[model samples]
Target: MRGSVVCKKIAPVGEVLVKVFPTEIIDSVGEEDAHFFGAIDTATRALRGGGVFSVSDEIEGAALLHYINVAESYRNEGVGSKLLDYSLKSMKSAGTKYVLYRETADNPINLIISYNFATDNGFIPIVENEKILSYKMETILGGKFAMKMMGKKDSLNNIIGIDDPKDNRIIKFNEDNSDVFYKLEKGNYDPCYSGFYVKDDKIVGALRGVLRDKTVILGDVYLETGYESDDIYTSLLEYVLILLTQDVRVENIVIQVTGEKRRSIINSLLGEPDAERNAIELVRYL
Candidate 1:
């Protein structure tokens, strides 16, 4: 039974997956959660001995390990390890730089097991609570940072670096920005919440944000391919930080970045990772 187990990606169908998957995920798959399993890059699968796993596509530059379940009978037989190994390999091949996993922390025993499992597989618990546990894959960073923000008050003009009073105008994202947005998107930027960086009446950069469950998730701090520079990055993130500081109800901030360039920028702005109360998120880096 041990050596015979094989792991592979499978459609989110069949008795094996349905039997082992969590009830909520089973329902979402039934409803066709494209966000969860729609992309060609996403993997949803079942393994030998009634085990199942799923990895979301690289959304906002990171893939999420959204689901994994091994039947009780298969728990001690290495099924989880086999499924995780396959999923990580596939995700890395798909150009995923970061991966994340989340587990409920309501049960102390389960939380401990989950934490141990994550660390064993190169993950670190960033957010630990009785309600939720967040784990991110561990990596050797140069060091940590202490967060800082500019003291001056920020507005659209200041954020866009518009010094000329004659050319100054603030463009908050709305229906009017849609035209310029689609042109810049070029099939890359799809934002649920965002701010645009305009300079001299032209859009030079964009800040994308998505709010989910009281957490504001940042997507892209994008300037055109060759047009990127350090200041542009700072202005964009500073705007988001200012906005978040103004909101009293926002519980957390998540930035999803693809390569070292953006990751470095995020690290600089955030100045080190801090866990939110009772919150859980999963993260991995390639």
Candidate 2:
């Protein structure tokens, strides 16, 4: 993938088509988590050689860019820089308000200078907690479970009431006569469109999904305190499996949580290790 390409705007098309580069070109970036965009040549009506690959998610009204690369054959011909310019322009046209990018702290060359590129383009660095190795479990049992969509107003309030009393300040559930409930009810809140497990109209647990290309990521699984019922947890896992089965685009489901809390749960549900690795660091745009 190298060369000059024409950029076209296709209307009535919700998804934009830039250029399509060989998947190998993108895999060379050495990160499995990257998101990619390409530019197409106007004259040839084919994808240009260079493209931009980064990490992006629908949080904080911005996309997080991790790495930018141009085909080796086309380096220093302004193709790479032009691709960056095109990416920003395209995102702006799509109504994106911010762009966040990062370079590994141990990068071998020009780490500071590379960060400057994003800074010059109006991006800023935000500090976050560094990740560490967490234990992994192989399998977990599957069982019957039910799912329901609940408004945050009722869910958050109920969760707050049941949480450990010592940690009540962690969430302002009932203060001010439940202002959080009011905000959730008035549409001023979005709890990331999560899914829940309920029995008899009472929420037993909850889960949320994040989509990345062909993956449906699940996280933030929480169960009501003092409700150590196996049925409740099983129901939550079953709900997750049902949702995953319905997503045709997803090839794999990934869940991340603290090693201590998830070890047993993962063993019971996921069963046998497919792969286990540690996340060294993680950053979110929001």
Candidate 3:
């Protein structure tokens, strides 16, 4: 059974994919989710084991290992290793700097970053971006964002903090005023989906986002640590959300934020996330 599997690139993607992956896995994945995952770049199968991969569009030089399934018959037979090895090699040759796998933390398999597999493949856990990052946010907010897109403000009524929009402090972000943001040169900033809340002639708070595929990834919510920090952060986020839908077609919202205050406010606005553990971002640098 071990040598029967012939791992290769671009395995057939139609009925064969569904047959390879269990119904629970493939059926739950939507067309938009597949599109957002990006790149039909790879699929591998033989002897009843296969996986799907996509380029991580929001994170430069990275490929996402979206799914890997080994049939119960083929389990523990090394087919999974061959598929991963080939996938990493393919990603590296194509100039992907790293491969990322995201999943809820502290599961039996640590979710997608399986421990035994990570040890085998040299993937490492990263703590840097956990405070404000996740693909899972899509699952929670996608429908509400769709409702917002349909001009149903009433649907998200309570969380819509600032409807007036007359606050001059909330200025659009651009290269010229990028200095107002704390880590401007290092962080991702696009004029269209970013703004700042200035008060007392200072940048008291700011909000930023990156638009990828159909989702607007809102992140880098910053504010001066002060008495009014809560209000400032809330207003800035609401401003960005409103700004996003009014100007562009926003089908989904992926938030990159954590911590007590941040999560509390986000929950108030978008509802509670799984929140028990941070979404783990595992990377294998090439």
Best by lDDT: 3
- Among these predictions, the greatest TM-score belongs to 3
- For model 3, state the Cα shift of residue 36 in Å: 16
- Top-down TM-score ranking: 3, 1, 2
**What does each candidate score in C-alpha RMSD?**
11.9, 11.6, 9.4
Candidate 3 structure quality by residue, lDDT tens digits, 1-286 = 2345666664446675665555555555533344111112123424466666666545557677767766766668776777787777877787888877765554534554464575577787653335443334454446354353444343233232222233333333232344322343323555567666654555555576767776777765765567246766776676666666565466666777656667777766666454344555567888
Every candidate's lDDT:
0.51, 0.45, 0.56
TM-score of each: 0.44, 0.37, 0.54
Angstrom error of the Cα, residue 175, model 1: value is: 26
For candidate 2, lDDT tens digit of each residue in 38-60?
A: 54555555544434444333343
Model 3 TM-score?
0.54
Better of 1 and 2 by TM-score: 1
Instruction: Evaluate residue 24 in candidate 1 and report its C-alpha lDDT on the 0 to 100 scale.
Output: 68
| Model 1 regions more than 4 Å off | 1-3, 14-16, 28-59, 128-282
TM-score: model 1 vs. ground truth: 0.44
Model 2: what TM-score? 0.37
